[model samples]
Each structure stands twice: as C-alpha cells, then as structure tokens.
Target: MMNIVQMGLGPIGQQLTRYLAEREGISIVGGIDPDPNKIGNDLGEHAGLQKIGVEIAPDLDSVALLDKADVAVITTLSSLKKVSPQIIEAAGHGLDIVSTCEELSHPWQTQPEVAKRIDEHCRKQAVSCLGTGVNPGFLMDYLPSVLTSVCQKIDKVKVERIQDAEPRRKPFRDKIGIGLTEAEFKAKRDSIRHVGVEESVRMIADAMNWQLSDVEETLELVKADRDLKNDRIDVDKGQVSGVKQVGRGYRDGKEVITLVFKAAAGVTHSHDTINISGTPTFTSTIDGGINGDIATSAITVNAICSVREAGAGLKTMLDIQVPAYFDEASP
Candidate 1:
C-alpha cells in the first residue's frame, strides 16, 4: 500500500483525505496541520469519516511516520514563498509531493528564482514534486493543451470559463467578491488577486514553445443587474456580484493565447469553452462547468500514482502522463 501523509486539513484537504481513504492500495499514515483545534484529532474525523487512526500533527517534524510516507499531499496556501518550507520539508524526508497550490502549478513564468530553488532542492532529495488543481492545472491549461494535440498547425487558442458562485463554498464566494459593492470590490481586488489565469497562459505558451512578447491580465467587477441572494451572502442590484478576469498572451505583435474567467452569483449559465483557431479550427464546450472544490481534491488525489511513477524531480502536469480515476478494484 502507498503510505501517504496529508498536509492541511481545510475543506479541500479534508475532501482529498476522504477520497484517498476510499482507494484500495492507499493508507493515510499521518497528517500535518498547524491549527490548534485540529491537532490531535483523527484525520478521518476531520474529514467527517469514521476514525481511521491517523492523527493530525501540528508540524511536519512532529510526525513520527514521516520517514515511512511515500507521498505527501499538500493543500495549503497558494503562494510559493509561503508554501515552500512545507514542500521542502516533505521532499527532504524523501517523499514525493502533490500539492493544490495554484502559483506552484507553473511558477517558472512568474517566479523563476523560487521555482529553480525548489526544483534543485527536490532533485537533490531525489523526490518528485508537483503542484496542480482543476483550474490552472487542468481546465484552463492542461486540458486545452491536450485538445491541441490533434491539430497539425496551431495559430491561436482561447479558453473561457463561466461559473455561478451561488453553489460554491463560502471561501470561493468571498474570494470572488460576490456580495461587495463596486468601491469595496476594487479595494480588495488588488489584495485578493485571481490565482490562475496568468499561470495558465504561460503554461500554454511554454507548451507550444511560443516566445510571448507580453502577457497581460486584467480584472473587472461583475455587477448584479438585480438583487441576488445565496446561502452565504446577498447583493443589492448594481452592486458587485463577482468578477471577470482575462489573461492574454502576445507573440510578435499577435495574440496567440487568451483566457477569460467569468464567475458571479447570478450567471445564467456556467460552462467552459475552448476555441482553437488552427488547422480544422476546433471548438469544444463543457455543458455544466467543473466544480472547482471537488475537482481540485479529486485531481490531487488522482495525481498520487502519477507522482510516484515519475521519480525524483520537480514535475508539472505536462511533465507526467495524464492521470485517471484511481480504481479501487484494479490489480
């Protein structure tokens, strides 16, 4: 069985642990979380499951089972700088890592120095490390890149995601500024930067080996046309419902890649669309949109075997083979 250590017992982390527990050849050896309330609690209980005997440790150093772990699934903060220490500690103990940190998904474009340091450290430790999730890691980047494999020649690519935030978690709704006024939204927008569009754009450009002259990103408020009420919050008409974020990549005076994310509380339809203006001009749309929280946890859990198979180095979604559902009955 694959001995796994779970880091961060937040919503996504809890979901990931639950999924991992259901897999046949997997064992939850330990858990790491700094939350005092969660410390000493059974990981299964934190995940709303029957106690599985693994307790949450306040820190990685305190986990006696660290040396026995084959992999560490980290679902902590998004910043590479903040999450670097946790990743380093895991890799130091000779454990492969699969994390849901968005920026770490493709840090080469925005944080080359930090990426190099982490890559070198992981390589020295002889453990593979990957950062991934549903948006930056898949729908906006990896999935779009996979679609382009059929094209003989590619000119431009555009991906658009429209999501209704009403059904999402409170953190997600808050992150998108669901119920803020126009002035309030602008104030928090700079602080709460949208995590993944730029990374997705860079990942696409790097995959195609296109030399982008510039990558531009812009965020604007999505106002509510009428009053809106959701489980979390309410918004008056003309107030901020959410946001529209766009990232564009240009190469030699031409825009080659474009990604647009529109998420709000009252959106009529929630879907993902990809348009490739290349040979055969392909366009595809996903009917309902991928659920960010659930899909993120599923992808992180599904990536475990892939990370183990890809030995000893810093890995990305593009570096390893595509992942699939972990069949509990598989031999």
Candidate 2:
C-alpha cells in the first residue's frame, strides 16, 4: 500500500481524507493542519469515518515518520506563497506530492521562479509534485487539450463551467463571493476570484504552440434574485449571490482561448461545456457539472501513483498519465 499523509484539514482536506481512507491502495499515516481546532483530533473523526490511529499534527515538522510516507496530499491555500514552504518541506523528506492548490496546476506560465524551486527540489530528491483540481486541472485546460488531439487544424477553444453555488460548501461559496454586498464582492474580486483562470488558459495555449501575448480576466458578482441560504451562509435578495468570472487568452493579440465560469445561487442550468474550433470542430458537454469538492479529492487520490512514477519534478495533468479511479491495490 502507498503510505500517504494529509497536509490540510479544511473543507476540501477533510473530504480528501475521507476519499483516501476509502481507497484500498492507500494508507493514511498522518495529517497536518495549523487550525487549533483540528490539531490532536482523530484523522478518521475529521473525515467522518470511524476512528483511525492517526491524529492531526500542527505542521509538517510535527508529522511523525513523515519521511517514510510515500506522498503528501495537500488540500490547502490557493496562493503559491503560502503553499510553497509545504512543498519544499515535503520534498525534503523525499515524498511525492499531489495538491488541490489552483495555481499549482500550471505555475510554469505564471510563477516560474517558485515553480522552478519546487521542481528543483523534487528532482534532486527523486520525487514528483503536482497541483490539480476539477476546473483548472481538467475541464477548462486538460480536457480541451485532449480534445484538440482529434483536430487537424485548430483555431479556437472555449469552455464553460456553470455551477450552482447552493450545493457547494461554505468555503467554496465564500470564495465565489456569495452573501456579500456589492461593494464587498468587488473589493475582494482579485483576491477571492477563482485562482487559476490564467493558468488554465496558458497551459492549453503553451501545449498547442499557440504563444500568448497576454491573458485577461474579469470578475463580477452575481446578484441574488431571491434569498439564498445554505447551512453555512445566507444571501439576501438583491445582494451578491455568486460570481461571474471570465478569462481570455490571446495569441498575437488575437483571442485563441476563452473560459467562462459562472457560479451562482438559483442557477437554472448547471453544466460543463467545451467547444473547439478547428477543421473537425466539436462540442462536448456534461449536464449538471462535475462537483468540484468530490472530484478534486478523487483526482488527487487517483493521481498519487501517477505522481510517484512521473518525472522527478513539478507536473501538470498534461505531463502525467490520466488519473481515474482504480480498484487494484497495486499498479
């Protein structure tokens, strides 16, 4: 079995622990989270499973026998600044890594220096590190890249991921600016908007040899037509219900890739769509969109083996075997 350690205990992290526990090929050896509420708690308790022997530690320095673990599954902050230290520490222990940090999906295009540092460490230690999640890692970026393989001549690629925010966790809902005043939403636009739009656009373009001059992104709050509330938060009528964020990537000043992410409460339709403009143009859609939380956890767990076998450096979905659920205890 692959020994794994969990590196966060937030909403996504807890779900990841649950998924990891369910996978037969993996063993949870430890967990780390700085949250005072989580430290000392049973790992299984946090995951809503029966008690497992592992208890949450406060940091990587505290995870006993951390060097013996095969992988560190990080479901943590989106910012590379905050997550970089964890990456470095894990690499020092010679552990492969799989994470849900949005920026990590394809940081070569955005934060090359930080990416280089992490890459260098993983390479020196002979391990691998990857950042992945539903939107950036797959639907908007990797999936479209795969679709283009069937086209002879490529022109443009567009993807739409429209989601209903009501079903999402409170953390996700807050990340999209739900339950805020118009001013509050706009103020946190740059900070709270989905973290990986530009990265997603650039990953596809770079893979296709479509050099981009620049990438542009815009964010606007979706107003709640009616009152919307879940167990975690509330949104009043005419207040901010969600966020509408769009990202455009241009090559030679021409828009070659466009990604539209619309997530709001009371959304009439929820779907993931990809349209490729080429000689053999095609459109693909998934009704009722992929649930982000569950998919992120599943992909991270499934990708563990892929990361361990990948080149000793930073990787994206483009660089590794396609990650999917597997029942075998060994690969």
Candidate 3:
C-alpha cells in the first residue's frame, strides 16, 4: 500500500480526502491546510466523517511524524504565489505530487518558469509531478482526444462546459459575475478580469497540433422575471435574475466551439457537453454543474491513482483514466 499526503483542506481537499481514504491500496497519511482553525482538527470531522484517527495540520513540517508518504495531492488555491510554496515543500520531502492549481494545469503554456521550477524540484527530490482538474485538464483537452478514435480527418474540434451557477460556491458565484448586467460583465472584461480557461483551449490546440486561430469570448446575463436562487431559495421578480456567459474557442478565425457557463441564484436546467467533428462527428455530454470542488477532488484522486499505475513525468487527464467514485468502507 502507498501512503499519501494531501495538501489543502478546503472544500475540494475535503472531498479528495474522502475519496482517497477509500482506496484499498492507498492510505491517506496526512493532510496540510494553511487555516489555523483547521490545524490539528481530526480529518474525519473536517470532512464530516466519523473520527478516523487522522488530523489536519497547518503544514507538512510534520512529514517525519506522518512517515513521509510516497505521494502528495496539492489543492490549495490562494494564488499561484502561495501554491508554489506548497509544491516546493512537497518536493523537498521527496514525495511525488498531483496539484489542482489552475496555471499548473498547462504549466508549459501560461507559466513555463513555474512549471520548470516544479519539475526541477521534483527531479531533484527524485519524485514526479502532475497537474490536473476539470476544464484545463480533462473536459477540454483529454476528452477531445478521446473523440479522435472514431474520426479520420479532423476539421474542427470544440468542447463545451456549461454549468448552472446558482449552486456554485459563493466565491465562484461572484467570480462568474452571475447577477450582474451584461454591461457590468463587459466592464470587467479587461486583462485583469479574464479567467484563464482560454489557456486551456490553447493547451488543447497545442496538444492536438491544431494550427493557429483566434480566441473570442462573450459574457451574457439573463435576468429572471422573478428572483430565483438555488433549488431552495426563491424571491420576487427583478430582484436579481440569472446569467449566461459564453467562453468560446475558435480555429482559423472561425468560431468552432463555445462553452456556455451559466450561474444564477435560481435556475431550472443546466448541463455540459463536448462536440467534435471529423469523418464522424462525435459529442459527449455530462450532467450537472461540473461542481468545480467535487470535480477537482475526483480529478486529483484519479491522478494519484494514475501515478501509482503509470510511471510519472508531467501528466494530464489524457494520461490517466477518468475518476470513479468509491465508498471508503466498501471493502
């Protein structure tokens, strides 16, 4: 059995711990969180699991106490600046790593220097590193690769990830600018405000060796005649409506695909799908909000599983199997 250390104890980290704790051949040796309140807390309690004898610590300085696990799953998201410390720490401890940091997903693209440093650190410690998550790692990149199996000549490829925002976490809800007016959304569209998913599209294009094209983005807000939030919350008309935002990926100056990501306090329907064209057009869709937190957790755990099975270097979701859910007590 391989012992593991997972960094970050936030929402995604908590879910990842639950999933990691379930593997028959994997043992969660320890966890790290920057939150002082969470430090020294029982891991099971943090995840609302019955006490299982593991506690969350403030840092991995206690690696010796934890027996120095064979691998580390890093999910902290404060900033790329803050996350670099965690990666350095894990590498210094001689533990292989799988991280959920955004820039790290396609490190070779957006942050080559950071990526190189991570690789150097891992190599110096004689360990490996992998960065992955939903958009940058799987849905956009690997999923597109899977579609190629049936196609002969690929003309265009598009991947769409649509989510209902009302149910998303508060931080993400605000980041998505859910209830804002269309103008308000556009006002913030300058360089400082744009999210990095475009990099994911670029990464996909690079991976597929697709020729250069243009990338365009559009954000839309749909106001409900009545105020609506989640499945539970409801309010009167015009208080604050829903929103629909689209992030598109294009090739050769033509709109090949678009990702419609939506969020609202209340909404009815939501789904995510990917469309590809070649000899035979192929499309695959997944249900629900993509649940960034849950998806990140599952993706991290799946990366860990892959690390054990596949000898590592820099890796992606295409380098491993899609995650599967399992109960900790199943055995």
Candidate 4:
C-alpha cells in the first residue's frame, strides 16, 4: 500500500481525502494544515467522513512522515511563493509529489527554473515529481492530444468548459460577485474577477509545438435579479448572479485555442467540450463539469499514478496516457 500525506484541509483537500480513501492501495498517513482550527481534527471528519476512521493531525512539517509515505498530494491555491518550497521540501525528503496548484502543469511557460529545481531534487532523492489538474493538465493538454490521433492535419484547437455550479465556500462566492449589475461588475471586474484557466491553453500550445504570440482574457457575468436557494446555498435573489469568463490564446493575431468557465447555482448548461479543426473537424464533449473539489481530487490521484509509473523526473499530464472511464452499468 502507498501512504499519502495530504497537505491542506480546504474543500478540495477534504474531497481528495474522501475520494482517495475509497480507492484500494492507498492510505491517508498524515496531513499538514496551517489553519489552527483544523489541526488535530479527524481526517475523515475533516473530509466530512466521520465514519471513515481517519483523524487529522496537527503537523505542519513534511519531514515528520517523509519516511513512512511514498508520496504527497498538495491541494493548495495556485500561489507559487507558498507552494514551491513545500514541493522542494517534499522532494528533498525522498517523497514523490502530485500538486493541484496551477502552472506546475505547464512549468515551461510559468516557472521553468522552479520546475528544473524540483526535477533535480527529485532526481537526487531518487523520486518522481508531477503536477496536474482538470483544466490545465487533462482537458486542454491530454484530451486534445487524444483527439489528435484521428486527425490528419490539425489546424486549430478550441476547448470550452461550461460549469453552472454554486460556490459553497463563502469567500470564493463573494469573490465571484454574483449579484452585481453589469455596470457594477464592470467597475470592479479586475479586482473581483477570479483567476481563469488560461495557462491550460499555453500548456497545450507548448505540447503541440505551436508558437503562441498573444493571449487575451474576457469576462461576462450574469447577475441574479433576486435571491436564490439551492443545494449549495441560499442567497438573496439579487446578490450577484451568474458568472461567465473566457480566456483565449492567439498566434499571430489568430485565436488558436480558448477555455470558457461558467458557474451559477440555479443555472443551465454544465459540460466540457473540445473542438479540433483538422481534416475532419472532430468535436468531443463530456456531459458533466467536474465538481471543483472532486475535480481537484481526481487530478491529485491521477498525478499520483503518473509519479508511480514515471521515472525520477518532472512530468505533466502530457507524459501519461489518459485513464479510461467506464460506466459500470453501461451494458
């Protein structure tokens, strides 16, 4: 069995613990969280799995269980300043790592030196290192590559992700500014805007050897005129409604690829689609938008698989074969 040291106890971290706990050949060995309130809590309960019999530990240092676990999974925010050291520290201790932070999936464009350092550390320790997630790693990079196998001459790539979901986290929901009028939203758009998935486009461009000259981003948020209540939350109908944001990448003034993110509680349309322009214009769509937390869980777990199979080096989703998903009752 491979022991997993889970870092971070936020929504994504909680879901990762729960989902990974269900899989075989994996065990939650220890956890690290800076939140004083969460320290020493039951890991299972922290993940809303009180019945699962795992407890959260108050340890913040990775060196404590570095010898016990084969790998570590980081589900922190995309801030490099905070996560880079954590990764290097883990690699230095001989633990393979999988992280959800952005840019790690496309280190060449975002942080080549950090990526190289992590690779060197992992190599010195004889371990593997990798980063992945739903958008940057899978949908834009790996999925597009899978589609290209059938294309004779690929011209352009377009990936659109539409997620009509509600934010259960209070801070993130407020950051989205759902109830603001078009004018108000426009007024504070830059400050209030959440980071979109543009790096995914660059990762794809790099993998396909496409020379990208420019990248542009835009947002279109639809406000709720009244209060609303649903599985995620009960908000004043007019508090800030729905949100739609798009990030596009261009090569020589031509849009080569793009990603669209949309979220709302009582909204319509929730799916992911990628269109490839080539000899036969191939288009593929997945029916559901991976729940942010669940998607993060899937990403971390997928990265773990890659780290185990890959040699001591730095890898992204482009380095592995995309796993196949089969509905158990499909027959």
Candidate 5:
C-alpha cells in the first residue's frame, strides 16, 4: 500500500482526501494544517467523509507516523517562495512531493535560484517533487505542448478558457475579484490576478524550443452590466464582476503563444478553446470546460504514484508521464 501524508486541508486539499479515501491501495496516513479549527479534527470528517482514523495535526512534525508515508500531496499556497521551505522539510522526511502551487509549475523564468535550490535539495534527499494543477499544469501549457506533437511545424498557438463564477466555490469567486469596484480591482491588479500565466507560457516555449524574446501577462476587470448576486458574493452594476487576463509569449516580436483566461458572474456556455497555426492547423474545444477544482484535486492525486516512481529532483508535469483517473486495489 502507498501511505500518503496530506499537507494543507483547504477546499482543494479536502477534495483530494475524499478522492484518496475512495481508492484502494492508498492509505492517508496523516494530515497537517496550521488552522486551529482543523488541527485536531479527523481528516476524513473534515473532508465531508465519515470519521477515519487519521486526525489532522498542526504540522508535519506533529504527524508522528510521517516516516510511513511514501509521498506528500500539498495544496497550501500559490507562491512557490512561501511553500519552498515546506517542500524541503517534506523531502527531508523522505517523501516524494506533488504540490498545487502555481508559481512552482515552471519557475525557471522568474525564480531560477530558488528552483535550483529546490532541485538540489530534493536530489540530495533522494525524493522527487513536482507542481501541477488544471490551468498552468494541463490546459494552458502541457496540453498545448502535447497537441503540438502531431504537427510537423507550428507557427502560433491560442488558448482561451471562459467560465461562469456564479456556480463556483467561494474561494474561486474571491480569487477572480468577483465583487470589487472598478477602482479597487484596478489598484490590486497585480495581487488579485491569476498567478501562473507567465509560467504556462514559459513551459510551452520550452517544450517547443522557442526562444521567446518577451512574455507579458495582464489582467482587466469585467464590469457587471447590472447588479449581480450569487451565493458567494454580490456585485453592483458597473462593479468588477470578473476578470480577463491575457498572457502572451513573443518570438522576435511575433506572438507565438496566447493564453486568455476569462471568468465572470454570468458567462454562459463556459468552454475551453485551443487553436493552433501550423503546417496542418487545427482547433479543439471542450464544450462545458474542465472544472478547475475537481480537475486539480484529481490530477494531484493521480500524480502521486508518478512522483514516487520519478527520478529524484524538482520536476514539472513535463518531466513525467501524463496522469489520469484509475482503479485498483493494494495489499
């Protein structure tokens, strides 16, 4: 059986625990979270499952059976800098790691030194570490790269993901600046926008061996046409109801990769569209789009075994085989 330690018990983490519980051959050995409310609670119960034996501890050090785990699934924070220490600590305890931190998806372009440190440390600890999620991990970067494999030549690539925020969870609503005024949204653009567009651009460029001259990421607020209210938040007419963030990768002043992310309170017919320009160009679209939360949790759990079997080092989705849903039992 593959023993696992879960770090971060937030919405996504909880979803992961519930998914792990349904699978056989995998045991959730322990859980760690600093939240006072969750520190002593049963991990399974907190995840909306019947009480299981594993209780959440305040930290990894508090999980006395840490050594029994073969891997760690982390969904704590989006910033790689803030989460790097936890990664090193987990690796030191001999656990292969799979994290949902966006910035770590592909850090070489912006945080090379820290990425290097992580790679070196993980190598020394003889454990592998990877960062992944739905957007930066799959749809925007890795998936586009994979699609390019069939193309004999490629020129430009465009990807657009549009979703309705009304049906999303509170955290998703909050992250996309759902109910802020136009001025407030403009002032906090840098802090409020999605975190990994540039990283996704970098990953695709690396995959295609493109020498990008410049890469740019920008976010614009989508004002509410009229008053909008959802279970999560309220938006006044003319207030920022959503966001339109675009990331572009330029090769010698020519745009080669374009990624557009749009989410709003009432976007109808949510979908993901990818178009490629090449010797034999094509376009692919998912009718309803992939659910970010569910896909993130599924991919994170699906990747646990891949991380364990991977070579020791800091890795990205590109460094391993594709992850997918599975069914099997263990001893």
Candidate 6:
C-alpha cells in the first residue's frame, strides 16, 4: 500500500483526506495542521469520517509515524514563498510531494529562480515535487494543450471558465467578493489576486514555443444589478457580486493566447469553454463546469500516483504522465 501524509486540514485538505481514506492501495499515515483546535483530532473525524487512528500533528516533525509516508499532499496556501518551507521540510524528510499551490503550478514563468532552487533541492533529495490543480494544471493549460496536439497548425488559443458562486463553498464565495459593496469589493480585491491564469497562459505559450512579447491581465467587478440571495450570503442591488478577469499572452504584438474567467453569485452561464483557432478549428465545452474544490482535491490525489512514478526533481503537470483514476481492482 502507498502511505501518504496530508498537510493542511482546511476544506480542501479535509476533502482530500476523506477521499483518500475511501480509496484502495493507499493509507493515510499522518496529517499536519498547525490549527490548535484541529490538533490531536483523529484525521478521519476531522474529515467527517469515523476515526481512522491517525491524529493531526501540529507539524511534520511532530508526526512520529511520518517515516512510513511515501508522499505528502499539501493544500495549505497559494503563495509559493509562504509554502516553500513546508515543501522543503517534506522534501528533507525524503518524501515525494504534490501541492496545490497555484504559483507553483508553473512557477518557471514568474519565479524561475525559486523553481530552479526547488528543483535542485528535490533532485538532491531523490524525491519528486509537483504543483497542480484544476485551472492552471488542467482546464486552462493542460487540457487546451492536449487539444492542440492534433492540430496541424495552431494560431490562437482561448479558454473561458464561468462559475456560479451560489453553489460554491463559503471560502470561494468570500474570495470572489460575492456579497460586498463596490467599495468593499475594491478594498478587498487586491488581497484576492487571481492566482494562476497568467501561469496557464505562459504554460500554453511555452508548450507551443511562442515567444510572448507581452502578457496582460485585467480585472473587472461584477456588480449585482438586482438583489440576490444564496444559501451562504445575500447581495443587495448595486452590491458587488464577483469579478471577470482576462489574461492575454501576445507574440509579435498579436494576442496568441487568451484566458477569461468569470465568477459571481448570479452568473447564468456556468461552463468551461475552449476555442482553438488552428488548421482545423475546434471548440470543447464541459457542461455545468468543473467543481473547483472537488476537482482540485481529485487532481491532487490522482497526481500522487504520478509523482511516485516520475523521476526525482521538481515536476509540473506538463512533465508527468497524464493522470487517470487509479483503480485498485486493476491487476
């Protein structure tokens, strides 16, 4: 059985733990969380499951059973700088790692030096590390890049994801400013940076060997034109509902790749659409959209198998073999 350690017990982390508990050939060896309230709690209980005998530790070093772990799945935060220490600690312990850090998804574009360092460290440790999730790791970049493989000639790539925040988790709604005034939204907007669209853009551009002359990003407020009420929160008319952000990559002064993301409480359309203008132009749409939280956890867990099989170094979605559902029943 493959033993795994879960780092961070937030909503996403808890979800991943629960999912891993139900899977075969995988054992939850330990859990790491600094939250005092969560410390000492059974990992299964924290995930809303019956006790699985693993308690959450305040830190990796505190987990006496961590030696059994083959990999660490981290979902703590999005910042690469903030999460580097956790990653380094896990790597130091000689465990492979798969993190949901957005910036690390394709850090080479923005933090090349840090990426290089992490790659070197992981290489020396003889372990592999990867940063992946739904948007940056899959839909916007990986999925579109996969689609282009069949194209005889590729010119432009466009990906749009529209999400309705009404059914999303409270953290997601709050992050998108679902129920704030225009001024309140503006005030908190800077704190809510759209994590990985630019990374996704660059990933695609780099995959196609397109030298981007410029990359641009724009954010706009999605105001509530009418009153809206959801399970989590309420929004009065004229209040800020969410945001629509666009990121573009240009080559030779022409936009070669464009990514559009819109998330709000009352969005009528909810789907992921990709348009590729190539030799044989084609478009693909996933109806009802991909659930962000669920998909993030799914991809992270699925990546564990890939990371274990990959070579020792800092890896990305592009580097590892395509991930698929791991079936225990398979020979």
Query: Quick one: best lDDT, which candidate?
Result: 5
- How good is model 6 by TM-score? 0.97
User: For every model shown, what is its TM-score relative to the native structure?
Assistant: 0.97, 0.97, 0.82, 0.85, 0.97, 0.97
Question: How displaced is residue 309 in candidate 1, in Å?
Answer: 1.4
Model 3 C-alpha lDDT per residue in residues 87-136, reported as the tens digit of each score: 88877877778888776666665567776787677667777677777766
lDDT of 5: 0.90
Better of 3 and 4 by TM-score: 4
Candidate 1 weakest lDDT stretch, 10 residues: 322-331
TM-score of 5: 0.97
Residue pairs that clash (backbone atoms under 3 angstroms), model 6: none
lDDT for each of the candidates? Answer: 0.88, 0.88, 0.66, 0.71, 0.90, 0.89
The whole-model C-alpha lDDT of candidate 1 against the native structure comes to: 0.88
How do the residues 245-288 of candidate 4 rate in per-residue lDDT, one tens digit apiece?
A: 77788889988787776666566667788899988897888887
- Which is the winner by TM-score between candidate 1 and candidate 6? 6
Descending-lDDT candidate ranking: 5, 6, 1, 2, 4, 3
Worst 10 residues of 3 by lDDT: 322-331
* Cα shift from native, residue 194, model 1 (Å): 2.2
Kindly report which residue stretches of model 2 are placed more than 4 angstroms away from their true locations once superposed. 229-233
Question: What pairs collide in candidate 3?
Answer: 165-263, 166-264, 226-237, 228-266, 229-265, 229-266
Model 1 over residues 1-331: C-alpha lDDT tens digits? 7899998888888888889999998888999899999999989998999999888999888887877888899988888899999899889989899999899998897999888988999999998999999988999999989899999999999999999888887878888888788888778877655697898999998888888999999988899999997556699999988889999999987989999999898889999999999996989999889998889988898888888888777788999867788685222
